[model samples]
Target: MAGDYVRLAAYTGIRRGHLLRLTHHDVKDGFLRLDRTSKTRTLQLVPLHPKVLSVAQRLPLGISDDGVRASWKTAREACGLEHVRWHDLRHTCASWLVQAGVSLHTVSEVLGHSSLAMTRRYAHLAPEHLADAINKLT
Candidate 1:
């Protein structure tokens, strides 16, 4: 579970289940390949951070998503993150991307979000980003 947290924090980004299900073969040129894209009508390839790749090297080539989800859920609860959901880790990823000044479109790609509208939930947390954007429009 420590491994899962480290992997989740360092990886391509959430959909932890998606990451858990990823096989070594999924890492490709410039992106972490997804077998399916649910929210987005089209397929996506998330650019992987080197840390994610490093973590991947430690796991078995193909780990089951269900096991990862169950283990992560249980472990987080034990660690007193009683309310944490796997999806919230995804949200944290999005929020971090927003705060770090990554463009909305790029964050959308990182999180496999279908649109910037969906990415807007974290916009308020970017500290001066919205203000900067508003200034541009003025």
Candidate 2:
């Protein structure tokens, strides 16, 4: 049902193309070694959430982008998740990390964003954490 792919996207925030291009050698010691061919055009070592480590560890290296997209569309429609694109899983990953109190800088690194600005969009999800940070200044 594409749950494995969905889980990886939601936990790693890796782009569809990167995920499709992933090979076993790219993952080791809980980090994904993304190459320069990725969307960011930078090499990155994104940490894998423990919860999804098994999925990523076993991820097959042969999946194609079109195959995943078609399967995802069908799976989402079947699950009544309308309007949810494959990329939305990455957004969900970022949003969840921010909500869970992970720093934007860390999330930026995991998402392979070149700068903090690209990760700022998830800042709103951590407002309470931000407020707590300000409170600690008192």
Candidate 3:
């Protein structure tokens, strides 16, 4: 269950609070419909990664914030990753997408960021994309 929670966080890029409120109903038509976002209080839809779709189908994930925190603490300590925070899972999702050559604009949308600037931080992860763009001009 805890592993499912971590996978959902790392796959969807959903915030902890939003993730806690997620229900099976949110997983529809290949997208996770977040009706109420913590920051914007607006709807956001994130396409479900194929690897995580099965996990998302089992939502309301049956784990509380405390449960997640406790599990994260234990797992991190056991793995000597005490410095890692739960939110880093969200970053992991974004970083993976960026490193895969997904545009930052699309990544921002996937993360439901209010502005493109918020996604720029991940641009550095895909410097090859920049090189490809410049190469196109030659």
Candidate 4:
């Protein structure tokens, strides 16, 4: 299940509490519908990559998403990572998307954030993402 834990962190970027509460129904055909415990009372539906889809398709009914998350810390450390909290995966995913030039609105929606206000925190990453704003003067 250590591998599943890695997928859980890599896929939905969900925190331990919400991941634990995940039921079989949460893993649908194309999306992972996360009812996040955080503020904003929003339901997040992130598109599942093909790899994630394959994993979700094989999850036994009523499997605990949280147990996987909890197990990940030890495994991650064993894999030679340090101070790598679960939340760090979320940041990593978001940062990678931002660096890839995905729009902020898209990132906000994917993260299930209520507004771009929170997503904007990563806005300054990767100078290329901001080149459009800076290039207007030319």
Candidate number with greatest TM-score: 3
User: Which candidate model has the greater lDDT, 1 or 4?
Assistant: 4
Please give, for residues 3-115, the per-residue lDDT of candidate 2 as tens digits: 67778888899888778767768889999888965455667888988987877777674566677788888888898987887888889999999988999999988888888
Cα lDDT for residue 53, candidate 1: 64
How do the residues 45-68 of candidate 4 rate in per-residue lDDT, one tens digit apiece?
878777667666554434465666
- Candidate with better lDDT, 1 vs 3: 3
How many collisions per candidate?
A: 0, 0, 0, 2
Please give the distance, in angstroms, between residue 60's alpha carbon in candidate 1 and its true position after superposition: 4.9
lDDT of each: 0.67, 0.82, 0.89, 0.70
Residue pairs in candidate 4 whose N, alpha carbon or C atoms collide under 3 angstroms = 19-66, 20-66
Off by over 4 Å in 1: 37-41, 57-63, 133-138
- Runs of candidate 2 exceeding 4 Å displacement: 37-41
Clashing pairs in 1: none
lDDT, model 3, position 124: 86
Deviation in angstroms for 70 in model 4? 6.0
Q: How close is candidate 4 to the true structure, as a TM-score?
A: 0.75
Task: For model 3, name the residue pairs that clash.
Answer: none
TM-score to true structure, per model: 0.76, 0.87, 0.93, 0.75
